[model samples]
Target: MTAVVSLVEHAPARAFPLPDTVGRALAASKILEEAAPDSYERGMWRLRAGSKVGVVAVAVPGGETVTVRITPKVPVARLFFLLGYSSDPAGWRDGMVDVAEHSELLPALAHAVERQTDRALRRGLLQGYRTVEEASLVVRGRIREAEQIRRRFGMPLPAEVAYDEFTTDIAENRILRAAVDRLLILPGVPQTVRTRLMRQRARLADITPLVRGQVIPAWRPTRLNTRYHQALHLAQVVLDGASAENLPGGLRMDGFLFDMNRVYEDFVCAALREALRPYGGRSALQAKDVHLDECDSVRLRPDFVWYADSGTPRIVADAKYKAGKRRGYPNEDLYQMLAYCTAFGLPEGHLVYAKGSAPHTSHRVRRAGTVLHQHALDLDRQPEALLAEIRELTRRMVAGVKGRI
Candidate 1:
């Protein structure tokens, strides 16, 4: 049995009692903290869902019958879809159908993993052997009997061989297999999905179990490796959500935290760059075009910079994941954009917000020629519609630039 705790977005903290075994797990994981002196429960947790929505789980002890589940008020499917954009924008559509059909985050993730694994299996897992040089009777690469003799004389024979061979037990396969293994144990995973995941894991028998804190090796992009990239990416996301701890049992997860702020920023920047391709202008993310001070010690990094044909900064844009005009557009953001415009010698800048009362608005500096345009994206909308909105914004940016030119 699991303890399902419902928390309203940005609401006051709520208390819940846990079994001693489970309580120990939560404390070790820090998923829940002690409430004030007045509250009687073992721990209190508050959910700050803000404008983004999704589900994350807390792992408990073996004997304990309680599990902590945090559910967001927003549609879980939509949230997962938006979250997917953070990791993959171009290929997100590849998983949206399954994402919208699943009600929980973990299942949706499972579906993604299964599909990617199937695709990878069809294409064939990349093979590359990690090199090893050892003293052996059989000669593989070369013999270093002299060094072996220097260190210690072998009783029978002495030879050192360094070689590389083909293997299916690479990091890519191990990571995918590990994620599948973890999902199989998670509650609320669909039986059908579990069956599919089990099959996928079986195919990766040669790969070793990914130990906790093991660094996944990076793979180069080739025809063989490219097919595994998306699958590997999704696997990494699932693996990162699971944290290991020393508690009543060997290791268990506390939960996963998805930072919607970073997700929105990455999506917006990537979408804008793609949208601007038709206009023949290049968009640079985290463009370091300006230094705030004379010493160049302090520098300004605008989220995006659109460069004109002549190789000059035409426009700058920033992504903000907040609500309404009051909270979304702050003095700090305005000041930062003003600095970007002044430094780049541009008269216009763009700010993309998560949600706003109006679709668009413009702000002009009190004593300057710069104008900041604010735009909003409703995350609840379909993924395709969201991309279309970005495309429209790009058109507006291009038109504005042309008029000035």
Candidate 2:
């Protein structure tokens, strides 16, 4: 029999009396390592989930399994909205990929993937031209002269050839196949969902399976691939957010989890960029060339930066998924935004937080002539209201820049 434990995101630590092997498996799993710290304390295992929320299962020795489920602070539907919008801001809409029927994240994701993939492949597998390179017995398309001469000793028999083959074994199908495989291995998938996923897997049986530890093949969105866009995007979300691994001592760990911190940041940046599009300037997420020092020794990457039409930075912003403390949001966020302002040579910088008790506030840095603005976004609001808040925030950002000029 398997033991189950439940925890809430960012809640107080709770102690569970777990078996030694089970505790060790959880500790060794990458999910816990990335989300929590020092899980084992005293006799009972003291576990607390940080920003990550989802379900993970560990198979220990002696046929025992342990599953840990972390519930997010936000509603599952809201969480899906954040994920969908962040994944595809232009194409994603509310109820586009419905998770209303399911309560938990994994089942919702599993069902969504199955439904979307089915719709994508309804007309049959999509075939695209994939470039191939191989040494063939007969020269087919274009022969590699250098390789043919050097490797074959100037022989004409087995030629090194390259050609484009139209096939269903492409990036899109492979990604969908990988997602189905991942869901099949996870423990919590409902039986009906699992059966449908198995059908999806059988449909994609002709597609190539993604190799472990290799970069996922990339696919671009185009008119021909329009039907596959939503399914491929959701497949990538699954591939990026889920993990399965074999642990030491004959244990296996598999999970599907999302870091709420990252989800919040991505949603804010994507929404802001969408909102700022009409302002006639380009917005960048995590621009790498930014630095705080003249000598380029101290590097800084703000979550969002908007450039004016003249190619000068007009606004810089960072996203914080943190709640405000008694005094306020940590002073570190303010200092960080201050640095972003200084580096970007902007009069103001912005920090957007998942709303806490403290309302929107601004502080003028002492002696720096730079202002740090903190905006709180209520994640619980309806999607329209939430995005409306972002548009309002965008207006304020643009207005501030124009006022300074």
Best by lDDT: 2
lDDT of 1 at 40: 42
Compute the lDDT of residue 60 as modeled in candidate 2: 78
Q: Point out where model 1 deviates above 4 Å.
A: 8-66, 72-97, 122-137, 142-161, 185-188, 225-229, 245-253, 288-290, 325-328
TM-score: which candidate is best? 2
Worst 10-residue lDDT window, candidate 2: 30-39
**Per-residue C-alpha lDDT of model 2 across residues 136-208, encoded as one tens digit per residue:** 9977889988888889998888889999999998888899899899889887889999999999999999888
| Lowest lDDT 10-residue stretch of candidate 1 | 45-54
The alpha-carbon lDDT assigned to residue 66 of candidate 2 equals 81
Clashes of 2: 0
Clashing pairs in 1: none
Give the alpha carbon lDDT tens digit for every residue of 1-405 in model 1.
Answer: 566655443344555554444545545443433323224433443222343223434455454444444454346666666556766666666344355377666677788789878888885667877766787778787666677667657644656566775788777778888888878877667898899989898888778897767776665546667778778877877776665455555435544444556667878888898888877767789886478667777689989888987887887899987655544466677788888788778899988988766667789888886898888887777778888988988889888888999
Clash number for every model? 0, 0
